[model samples]
Target: MDSATSDESIIAFDKWLETPPGAYVRAWEQACLDKMVANIFGFNAVQIGMPQIDALAANRMPHQWLADIRLHPRQSGTGRAVAVTLDSEELPFATNSMDLVVLPHVLEFSAEPHQVLREVERVLIPEGQVIVCGFNPVSLWGLRQVRGRLTGSHYLPKAGEFISMPRIKDWLKLLNMGVSQTQLGCYAPACRTERWLARYNFMDRAGPNYWPYFGAVYMVQAIKRVKGMRLIGPAWKQKTAKAGVPVPAANKHKESIDG
Candidate 1:
């Protein structure tokens, strides 16, 4: 998609996030994000796009930024003020500068999703992590979205090229980023109204156990690994003992006699 089209799609998606179904997805994503980022220790973190959800609020990182292709203020959610506006494929930050990077629904909307992943990998320090949230293309929600497109009505944003979890994993693997953790949620069927959503709430409870792989959305956490490098603990933990000084034979004999 062209930049103009992409921007429009993102804006529409942002607006959709305020709707009942959009809010439903946002709630699940927010909860997942909070848990995924809470324990991530880092100095710098960046959340790219979808300012409708604060993807890093639970994170304790001292320096955090919210970035997007276009500056959008927080509307229905709490998040950091937009710190930077730039393309996902071309981050302005220096290579290996970020400790954590959050991509919430960015890949699905981007024209060059692989390039975005490459950019993320370039900015992350060794062992630094990236958390990605995306709509699953293999669920009931996915079916509805497809049907919506065929009938000239769209359930999700038309610009979205929904990617499956396996594809995302492969993309990360190519960048030497290993998937460390994952979460799938929002099993409720695709319903426009809040009432119907509530009626199908039972699916949310039973989805994981019965239909584990077909959730509407997924969150993935991957860690960057540099070849032939391993993280070491504090230097004090690996301290070595010093060699003992040698003593003259006469002094050693005298000390023995005294004893």
Candidate 2:
């Protein structure tokens, strides 16, 4: 990946994390992860975003896979072991090691977005889920570039580079990941003054599936692909159990009959 882009991304994310409002942003970030868990299940999950928030809720709602992702000590509710890592470079874990990877704001802020996406692919299991969240350069965040420079938010540079949705999709394609869903947010810069507009419209009107400030960050869930990719399952053992006593799933009770 590009070194310059990677460096920029690291700086941006670190700075964003340091901000006072980061906690709120962190809690709010579960939008994409919640959707991923709702749409897909059965795979072991990995929450790669900030502080590794295992608690996620969105339009679709969080499900079983939500628990599979180990959360950090500080963020993990029950104190489970959680490993933190970056996306612009190779992870310590082996390739195809993760069933699901969440990359929130890790790419847009990074100068080398492709590198981050590639790294995501490297750690993902085949047909694994990848949910990415970032600012929409065309919407409120983009406008924030101007407003930020005016008010000097410090987070935004006076002038610099930005990433777009189409560009992100192209990068994913290059990495052999297919875009399953895309949504925008924080329709505007999402400041304290715009609370009403941000809440009332973020999930419904700002974009096709989301609304304004919609958190000011958007989410895209993609799937890694192999030569032959197929859907996994609905875990319906009862449907097949009627025919004969077949193989028992992970948690089923073992039974036997003796003469």
Q: Which predicted model would earn the best lDDT? A: 1
lDDT by residue for model 2 over 155-240, one digit each (tens)? Answer: 44332456677777888888889999876644434443335434544444535544333345567778899877686766677667
Number of backbone-clashing residue pairs for each candidate, in the order shown: 0, 15
Give the per-residue lDDT of model 1 (tens digit) for 1-259: 8888888888889878888999999999988899999999979999998888888889999999888676444443573578778989899999999999999999999999999999999999999999999999999989998998889788888779999999999999999999999999999988899999999999999999999999999999999999995878776655532234468899999999999
C-alpha TM-score for every candidate: 0.86, 0.60
**Cα lDDT for residue 71, candidate 1:** 47
In model 2, the Cα lDDT at residue 244 comes to 83
Provide the overall lDDT of each model, using Cα atoms, as 2-decimal numbers. 0.90, 0.57
The alpha-carbon RMSD values of the candidates against the true structure, listed in the order shown, are 6.5, 14.3
Where model 2 places Cα greater than 4 Å from the true spot, the runs are 1-28, 55-81, 84-88, 147-151, 154-161, 193-215, 228-259
| Model 2 deviation from native, Cα RMSD in Å | 14.3
Stretches off by above 4 angstroms in model 1 are 71-76, 229-259
